[model samples]
Target: MQDHQSGHQRLTLSDVQRPEYLANPYPLYHRLREHDPIYWDEEMHAWVLTRYTDVVAVLRDPRFSSAWGPVETAWMPEELRPQLEPALRAVSRQMLFLDPPDHSRLRGLVARAFTPRMVESLRPRVQRLVDELLDAVQDQGEMEFVADFAYPLPAIVIAEMLGVPPEDRSQFIVWTQDFGRLLDGGHLSFEELLTTLSGIADFLAYFRRQIAQRRTAPRDDLLQALILAEEQGDRLNEEELLGNCVLLLAAGHGTTTHLLGNGLYALLQHPEQLQLLRENPSLAPTAVMELLRYDSPVQLTSRRLTADVEWAGRRFKAGEEVLTVLGAANHDPEQFPDPDRLDLRRTDNRHVAFGHGPHFCLGAPLARLEAEVAFTTILRRLPQLCLATEQIERLPSLVFRGIKALPVTFASVLPATGATAAAED
Candidate 1:
């Protein structure tokens, strides 16, 4: 372990201690991706995997394990260890943290709900929500792109599908924020992690109560489907059900929020692309895919080696931890030409914004639908939208690339309480 105290290394561990790295890790990632595509982290006892070919390969390879791992002390400073450990353990309990067979089973449980047909069914309702939200912004003259638009939209949609009442939607916001915070991995304290764990515990307790209610009083909702699934012998015990519910809600809210935020931010940054989207509403789908490829919200993913294996001309021992820098890979010049520039019209954009292989995001259909509706509606309705502030703040999260606040000015808005702004900044 080199300089285990500060968690810093010259070029090896530069990202850990550099504040600039948190802002835009691309330059650092480029250095690591091009030079040391695979390097051992002595302090963390892990390998950093950063390259398009290597990342995509490892994600598809069955030898890497998302779940199997022995618990240990945190690789960071002692003070950060207590908080980091519990969050890691709790996250490991989710399906994202599971290996095959179990991963297949857990994923299959909610797979039907997010399929193309099911997600498509929500289109009319999604359009209505989009219209209602845009209607409110129609007269406001200014809108906080995140608060007034992106963040709340996905939560509402997912909550409706999950059988949560309209009034309780705010609670999901709290839980999702806490969930995102723990995974951010940049500025969280041990105490903050414990506090967030309490939030998760509270959410689980509520979910258990909801599950019992659904068991007795079945309704035409996804939660009911999950409950009745057990009666049909597709049993999901309390732990799995609760864990999966949290997983769905968090993923449902998090990624979609990023897709909308990142996509919209890209539009604001590039006016011609925004005009291109406005000129051809039919281009929304491709624009969304390009946005994902250009600046993925979830920047990277982590995996552990289950066996000794050779990859990209490097050998690794069993039980080694590896970090796959997906954001860097999506922008790899080898994969996408002139990767730094945003090409809304870019075809053949098969980037792994939702990941690849068996662990591919189950909620992809829903995410795509949500993003399509959100981005298209905004461009069609508020074509004159522009940034109110030149400076945009980002959440200090390495795993997800998203804006903390995005203030913008629009020409006008429609009358109603449908658009309420809650800019945290």
Candidate 2:
């Protein structure tokens, strides 16, 4: 990729998905902050807000909509909706795309299952799962972390949490990668769009079956809880129930999967921090914050104006959109000191990698718990861990960022059984 500069407008639309930008977007983000803080891009046709303060405001402001009306159908434009009504019904039920009474109600119901006690209760399970994943590859002395470990940890946890059968988890991975294109598909062709929608159709059908079984004989899992959840005379309708299950699976799985992959890559790049973390694996929780800030998995999210108005000293009309570059804000020098350096013990980390305000990720505590368990188990079990190869492929999407695979070599050791299980927290 060649660098070009033009009259204080040094960034270009092409830079958004360039290999160099994907590999190290922070430098480009820094350049944007210096040259054009709230610049508009002709490619996306959306205003790009890079400053941390400006980004947070849009995330919190009610005027900026999730614009979920289109999400119901995998974000198919108006022309395509008629042929894709099934998908529209399913995803619209997801809470990530909801607002007001619906978002509040769905969040209130799901919150019960994701509380501190609830998340803590699963720590042992998470630990055991991590150990099991490592045990499978412990003797190999090398493994692809993303495929072997990172991708499965939260996926299995969330699948079981929602009553998805163990045998079904593999299919979940395939479905997730396809359905996730709803948000960020850069210049996707019509054929590619249809392929994604077909996946969404399959996902809705799979969950519908599980949801039906729960209806007949409700289990004591998160999906059943969601089915039975009620709030202040409000209950999730059928569409709401199924759509949210779709939402939870996507939201619950994607972020943490990338966290481990992205976080481990960050650690491998910064040996000092890796050494510090290996020395005190208990520091994994705090370290997760810096990992999120350093290379956020969800790179950027957008909000559309609900009413014509001026914000951040700029004028905007209703229906316009503002894209918040979280990776850039996480690297904002004004908010974080030495923003580019990976500091494992940084205490002032308040990055919005999981987002902020009303739509703040409901599954944050669970993601954190899963990471803590994954890092500690990996560091404790795999000694002398080092990257097998420096070359890694990252998903080339506008909204999501993650490695496709991470090969690493580590000293082999006898598999250690998890300490006598602690009574549930």
Candidate 3:
């Protein structure tokens, strides 16, 4: 309701591109929300869309494009352009990062593997994985929740879906960790960015080898479905296959890992809610939704204006950079009252954590199921669980907010009866 253009045009890049803001963006977000909700940054030569509604509108708006660069012009810095040109060229083929028609096509091709029935069919399997993970954590007095529980739940689920062998999960851990590091806009040095690009090359090499094997000898898994997916003689090209694989690995793993880690951290911080959850196991379904809304894992997404557009009495030029702050949008007072408070019992909570419109996450059901199983199993089995470390360390990426390590200590070996108990020794 407040739009004042007179004094706001003096905004500089330092205002939004500060390292301190990355550490705790909410304060800067508050300032921006109050003064200039949609301001342009000169340093990055881009516009920033911060207000909750504005961010959501941009994400759902087709006039604002998802495919920003890396097509004829990759977005990488000029210094490393020579080294990364090949890999950066493939970035445009990714489904989440692509535009309509292509985005819709690639998303649809993979949608069959993630249909509701397929996700539901795996519930029992997911429950088993959660049980096994929780049982291992229960035998120890202390555990790093992220490593011991959070990271593995979704990593395993994604691996199973992609037909990755159990032993190869370590590869995914390395790839995902490196991928996360390269995304740190505030902290990623040139060397680290190149390292991530190198890792991508390695992953592509591995995927190519695997694709060859899968193509010759198909299996009953998602990878096989991808390999065989053909519509009127249309199939994924080599670059598209590799790009989608990277997309799946990056999107599928990071979000779910943070979802579990962020959710459990919230529960531990709020003991009353933890106790309530321990008392009612059936509340897992509702609790997962609250967890997503309270502390969304993926904080922001980027877009570029394909054409000049006006909204809320402000005009944006074409080819401008727009950052949709999902974290802030999820906490907007206009949309969610007491946006700072976490309400597990709230009935009418509609959040844009997974995004909105055409960009809504395709893996929502699977991620939800995994979190439900992971959190319920952790809380139910380890009632004595409490933080072993006073201050948990978060991952260094601004785009993804998750604990790098969550040191938790428990009173005893609270193993669920009849469940296999494997010590974390």
Top-TM-score candidate index: 2
**What TM-score fits each model?**
0.88, 0.93, 0.88
State residue 404's C-alpha deviation in candidate 2, in Å. 0.5
Candidate 3 pairs with clashing backbones:
70-74
Tens digit of per-residue lDDT, candidate 1, span 1-425: 22222234355533633567666677777777666778776644578776788888899898988884665554545675554554445556678888878788877878888889888888877777777778877767888878777877888888889897756767887888888776654556767866777687767777778888887888898888777765666456555667777888888887888888888888989999999998897988898889988878888788878889987667888888788878888878888898888988999888988888888888888888888877876776774789988777776676888887888887764432222221111
- State the C-alpha lDDT per candidate: 0.76, 0.81, 0.74
User: What tens digits encode model 3's per-residue C-alpha lDDT throughout 1-425?
Assistant: 23333364553323433556544556656656666777766554567666777887788889888784645535577886765665666655778778888888888889987888999888777877777776775656788888877887788888889987766877887877765665544556667777888777677677778888987788898777777763124667667787788778767877898898889888998998888888886888888888888888887777888888887787888887777777777777787888777767766777878988788999998998888777767776675889887766666565777777888987765545443232111
Evaluation by TM-score, superior candidate among 2 and 3: 2
Could you tally the backbone clashes for each prediction?
Answer: 7, 3, 1
How does residue 100 of candidate 1 score in lDDT? 79
lDDT winner:
2
Candidate 2 collision pairs: 72-88, 73-88, 308-318
